[model samples]
Target: MSVINYGQLLQLAWPEIILTVAALIALAADLLFFRQSALRTRFLVAASIASIGCIAAIFKLLPGSSEGMLLGGVFLSNPATHLVQIALLVIAILTLFLSVDSTFTDHVGEFVLLILLATTGMMFLVASQDLLVIFISLELLSLSVYILAGFDKRSSRSAEAALKYFLFGGMSAAFMLFGFSLLYGFSNSTNLVQIASAIHAVPLNPLVILAIVTTVIGFGFKIAAAPFHFWAPDVYQGAPTPSAAFIASGSKVASFFIFFQVLVIGFAGAEGSATLHHFQSGWVPVIVTVAVASMLLGNLVAITQTSLRRLLAYSAVAHAGYMLLAYVAHSEQSLAALLYYVATYALATLGIFGILTVTEKQLGNDKISDLAGLSRRAPFLSACLFIFVLSLAGIPPLSGFFAKFLLFTAVLAVSPGSKLLIGLIIFAIGMSAVSLYYYLRVLKSAFVADPPADATPIQSPMLLQLVVGLLAAGVVALGCAPDLILNQILKVIHASGL
Candidate 1:
């Protein structure tokens, strides 16, 4: 191992450091203002501090052009890392905005602080190149989320959600750690590059395949892929809306990026080698099966949900399947497609959840019927929600359509002649069509159904309206000119030397 220098490490890790400092400052402020009668003012102060930290981190990340290993190969910093960090921070800021003046106001400072810490962990997770670093960062992210999920101590459902998530997360961590140990035993190193080099020197073994399967299963749960996705709907339904949004967006994005790194870096072998063939053949079938199952099951089950949050939770599972299609293609192009699709999905999802937060606060429930006549009560909110839901359903002239197009195009480009791939593609298309039924069901409730006699117009805060408007505009912009983002994605891919 190379000796590490603290100064250089701090420079490479400036974003995480800034985030940590911000979290600490928020914690101190929370303690100082715990007895303040004006809860809103306290929350705003904390949020402002967190936002400043995020801005500072973004500035630190934007200027760097160097790309190389950091801290003796435990972490990496490249264009891809920078992009993921920026996404995590942006999502964190949005989440903080959503929490303000909402149910989380009672503990707003802690809430924002936890989100900052979780975002920092996500940034580290994406940059990690060592098994130990990945595990530590994942734990940091997961622990903060577990608390955030149950932050509404007054709600039984929230408590139940946190408990279930904790249990499942613990199990997944064990599986992943064991898998990492197995890999280390084989390679005598925790670094991904070294593992790949070591694996290429030996014949394929059952243990190696087992490690791959175990690790993928662990990651499968994180991304809410099928068969391992039973916890998602329950958690999403019960958690605070902003917490659910963060889990669905920031956490999912980081998980997929790290999973991609583990597969492409740790298992890859020399060109034309038996080990490379073995790794590909071993994992491709597993991912394909997971993707197909996630799409079919998630979409089919979502149609029956009357609760808006549960319905979106199942929709998320289906989206996970769509993102996995990129991995099935297993190329740099596919990775770019996955990133673009997730970024678009995150924007739409956060917008919808932001609207839900306001609606839930006004009405005290998230039932599908609760959205009835939303257009009459809050036309702008209704319009934003419509755009987001339509985009999620992959309707034309929206970001979701282009995202799905890129994913399918990437996969088909690689495996055009494979009968299995063709069948899976058709199945995915059918499932996407099925998904439209449920998405439109929500829209119909919002736009066409009658409002209750007691219903009153919604009065959302200006900040939330601004956030939703920006996200909705983003979806439209991406749909109209996907190349704007795709070109940047291409640049990142090239910069990474992949």
Candidate 2:
């Protein structure tokens, strides 16, 4: 925390700094140079700049480094953190590419700028261990996304989605902030490690219990867990497609990672237990209840959805539940498994939305039936959709399949004798089966059903198709070779002791 160490703050935060610079540059370029250009031209230029900035930040993270924590953990850099940040940037860059063809808003520069700003927030959110920094980063990301959701000013649905997102997000922030205040009051420190040390001395006091519930409630909303997921279906259906994609992909990665950190590191000794017939009073049980509710509700409701976006939104809630299983298990391996599951999940959802962007434009709606005979109209995209959905459904030799496999394996490894753990895993597996039915329903529309008599062939932008193709290939590559990313994640976790 010395002055010279403060000097290293810039070095530690170079990725976020680069992203901010990129955002400003994009804004300026759009205002000064492309003010009257065609909308496509503006989007092309802005996306190129934004993509370069993301690539630069990724390169900055490429070199190996010993872990560093500066500014009393307000800034942190390590291999594990870098990996997650890289994943976030990748998702952002893909989203940027996906947006190039969108006509939702003519403010091309502003759109790109907000994407970069949101990426910057996610980078900081995943890297920092300080509660204050985390809160600021969350708000930064949230505010940008709220605006982006309502970016299509011409649409009443867009405006409504943005309002609901903002209101719920504000309430969640307040809850999280109050929880942080309680933690700070108890520990007299804003640092997570310090807070953990303090709490270890008086594990699960009434105040700490309050803090845990409030904090979980706050994060639950972010991850779109059940009972707090009122905004997701609307946002998914109403927001600009690219905005929805970013919210589902990059934000999920950063939020879940930090949530894990707060619980496993900051609330270490208060895990209690979620074992069946041996339930304990702690955060674990709270997580277990949310997970169970999310799994059941998300899957069942998705079965009734006709709209693709709402179906995916409900599916996202179910996926959130599955990812929370990692929290319940709370093991080193579970962390790795969670990252893999969430990362692959993000890629799959991004591709789905990318396709939806094109299909919705071509068909004038995003209903499942609207995609009828997609295999005939846009064979390549239909194929990609097949891959993305099956991956999400956890089909074999696909990344989603492996992600669930590893996650379930990790949870079972912890207290295999615990009936509660076994039952939860069984329930998760059953829900995965239920998820397959709905996902297959999508495929049936695209492949098995016939299109309307007046239907025309769908034509998507080359850039959009390229982005979606890459996402699909990524899903396939990661699934066929699970170790490609998982090994690196494990190595980083082991090295960083995270």
Candidate 3:
């Protein structure tokens, strides 16, 4: 066993420590100094502090930060993990920016504190290579998010969402813990590499298969994949906009990153083929099955939704399916593809939710019809929405398009002439087309439909508008220059020898 190095661990964990300090400071400032301040003023101060802390964390991770393992592999630091941690911080910052004008909760300090805490959990989550660390980090993250979901105490829907999320999360955690215990019993180690070595040496057994299934169940709920995704639509619709945004963005990056690691690293030799008619009994086949269900159910059901958040929830499920395709490939290129796709997809989804935050505040609803004549009332926001929605629908010259292209190409590259994968790609393409219909319904409401006679222009805060615009611009820039982010991801993957 490796000796625990307290000093080295602290050196590697400075970024998370910074964020925790910032969370406490934000909470204290809100309770003591800003309790009587205006909601907007309180939000501004807390958000500024949080943003600055996130910036500090990002700087800590810049190019030359320490990289090593600690606590017998309970903690890990590597270029790839640092890259993901940076992305999580960036998403948290953006979520904070979008929350500055929120009125759902007056407890600005607590809200921001929870966000920071959740982000800290995510940072720890992506930096670990041990099952014990992973489970603990996930619980920390999940607890914080459950509170955030119901932060709007005035709304019963918010409370209900929180209750449902907590219940489902508890069950998933139990399942994941059981799976981890089985893995520990099998390998006598919590370290993923050692677990992989053990798995490689033994024949695939019933207990190993059970562990894989239970582990998948746990992560499936996290990523909002179908069958295990019953909690997502409600949570997305009932939770406060900022909470949903964080769940969809930062939480997703962390969850998917760890999921990839657990499968590709911990279950290395057990990846049975997922190719059509050639399916082997491994994690890949399980993921492929989930992917198919998510794509079909998410797209087909989204077409019937009128609520914008619900539609996006279903869309997220579908996008999760697309993202899962990378796992089917399970190569370094697939890792890069998955990261780029999830990052870009998260940006687009967050931008859409940001638009909802503004429009819902002004119009009093997030129904598709609430956006009627949005172009006439809020042209800039509408234009931003155009970019965001189109990007999400995988329209050309947008980040979503390139993300899908890279992912599909990577999967195809994995098996040069596999008919099953080809068919899956074709089905995914069809679902993308199906997705365009619902997305256009949103655009049609914003651009083509006539406004209510009493409608007035949406008066979004300038800062909020700017943040949303920046997010839309990011989607566009990434799409137009896919290599910009993809190259960075590839560099980290290579540097870590992933």
The C-alpha TM-scores of every prediction are 0.95, 0.98, 0.98
What's the lDDT of the predicted structure labeled candidate 1? 0.86
Residues 356-402, model 2: lDDT tens digits: 88998878889898888999999999999999999999998999999
lDDT per residue, candidate 3, 3-39, as tens digits? 7778998999999999999999999999999999899
Clash pairs for candidate 3: none
TM-score of 2: 0.98
Better of 1 and 3 by lDDT: 3
Worst 10 residues of 1 by lDDT: 270-279
Candidate 2's displacement at residue 393, Å, is 0.5
Which ranges in model 1 have alpha carbons more than 4 Å from their true place?
A: 33-37, 63-66, 200-203, 269-281
| Global Cα RMSD, each model | 2.5, 1.3, 1.1
lDDT of 1 by residue, 95-151 (tens): 887777675548777788899989988999998889999999999999999998998
lDDT of each: 0.86, 0.92, 0.92
